[model samples]
Target: DVKVTQSSRYLVKRTGEKVFLECVQDMDHENMFWYRQDPGLGLRLIYFSYDVKMKEKGDIPEGYSVSREKKERFSLILESASTNQTSMYLCASSFGGRPGYTFGSGTRLTVV
Candidate 1:
């Protein structure tokens, strides 16, 4: 089975601090995505990378960025974490957009 792993299951950060969330997929999928899910908001894409060193901004990319230096690995960076950024961050991957999307367990972040 394909599996996506996130670095943290829960995180607490203060406002104005940089945050890093790591993700790795064992399937070596070509597409990796970062999304933040909130109550009543569903899943909103933050960024996605189709290949190494290439990325595309998704629906909500402000204050967030991503890196894909190697296959099977992707990272999300919050330049300056904020209270509004406190949400459940999810990492997902797909094999050439087939088989739909496989998501990580998610990182529940709280900013105070």
Candidate 2:
């Protein structure tokens, strides 16, 4: 079972509210990243994990946080979302020792 699941396909939130994005992988992967996709910015890494319970900040970590309490579950949190945070959020699990990743369908967030 090699699947990466994202909790939502479309989400709408207001500025200054907290938001949560959930992801799960059934492949037992040890590494993955939360990326935000914008038209011009492309894919920007928000957070990444080395393994369970351990994480590292990526390119854009100022407004986001991640939780990897379990091997299969990872959560992205937006403490105080702003309008600029509106974008597609993707969760991808890396293949062990390989330079590949299995990506989720992505959650399109609209923060207004």
Candidate 3:
């Protein structure tokens, strides 16, 4: 089974602070994604990478960025976090053109 691990389960930061979230996958999947889940907005894609050194902007790419230096690892960066950005962040990995994805446990971020 594919396992996605998030570095942090919970995070609390003040407004205007920079934050970094890391994710690692056991499977060598080609596609990795970062999503921010809100109550009504559902899961909104922030960023995704198909291969190492290649990335694409998703539905909600503003104020966020991603990196995929290795096939099994991906990182999400919040450039100067804000209060409205506080939400549950999810990381997912899957083979390209697959049906479903293996999701991480999620990291709940709170900006005060």
Q: Write the per-residue lDDT of candidate 1 for residues 62-112, one digit (tens) a residue.
A: 999888989999999999999999999999999885868999999999989
Clashes of 1: 0
TM-score of each: 0.96, 0.96, 0.96
- lDDT leaderboard ranking: 1, 2, 3
How much lDDT does candidate 2 score? 0.94
Q: C-alpha displacement of 90 in model 3, angstroms?
A: 0.3
Model 2, residue 74: what's the lDDT?
A: 91
Task: Please provide, for model 2 over 3-55, each residue's C-alpha lDDT reduced to its tens digit, 9 standing for 90 to 100.
Answer: 99999999999999999999999998889889999998899999999799999
lDDT minimum window of 10 residues, candidate 3: 64-73
Clashes of each: 0, 0, 0
lDDT of the candidates, in the order given: 0.94, 0.94, 0.93
With candidate 1 superimposed using the best TM-score fit, by how many Å does residue 9's alpha carbon deviate from the native?
0.2
RMSD of each predicted structure? 1.0, 0.9, 0.9
